[model samples]
Target: MGVLSNLKPTESELEILQILWEKGDCTVRDVHEILGKNKDAGYTTTLKLMQIMHEKGLVTRDTSSKTHIYKALINQQKTEQQLVTKMIDNVFNGSAARLVMQALGNHTASKEEIDSIKKYLDELGNK
Candidate 1:
């Protein structure tokens, strides 16, 4: 709902952004190593994906040092909001109530989580 409302990075780019967000700034090697821990991506693949992300302005690189450090240019919350908005529009036919119903029905909600959601809804009503 903020800036970059139309920006939607690919799944791989999002994965890299997650790493950058968690690790702050990282080199290709650092990303590759972390990615390799879960999947079978080659170092070159990681490097090429990062290069594309940089070109797309999804990330920024500092080349002052020998190894370039890449950081996510987009904020995580903004990106998440953009993605969720798109999902609601496309998958729920712009029906937020339908989306919320499907989510709550499909997943098990703990009492604490349900209470939290109720509190948030109450706050929205106050607003």
Candidate 2:
């Protein structure tokens, strides 16, 4: 698969993607207002990015009305899985165990969450 075959997003594009993922589908104005809270993004920037994203096949555009509505074309879970695999390959030499171990060592988990994780590990062991 191409690096972005599953779904690749450039750094600047992620903010808009996040909005789509969060809001389901929205107009450029809606995405701009939400992003404007965190950054100096303008309405036209949102408009241009949506157009570019539509061209990239990252999103679908509906021109059924005066205002265009944008929606993500890819599944969020699948995209995240691809991104995690790519990150593990690049930063952890593709050793998922090492990546999990590092993250486990670096972050603290609640006891309940730890128990859940152990249960999941047990389930995987059975498989």
Top candidate by TM-score = 1
In terms of lDDT, which candidate is strongest? 1
Tens digits of lDDT, candidate 1, 10-75: 899999999999999999999999999999999999999999988989999999999999999999
Question: What does candidate 2's lDDT look like per residue over 27-67, in tens digits?
Answer: 98888899899989778887888899888988899999998
- Report RMSD (Å) for each prediction in the order shown: 2.0, 2.4
Q: Positional deviation of 96 in candidate 2, in angstroms?
A: 1.1
Q: Residue 75's C-alpha lDDT in candidate 2?
A: 70
lDDT of 2 at 84: 84
**Every model's TM-score:** 0.86, 0.82
Give me candidate 1's TM-score against the actual structure.
0.86
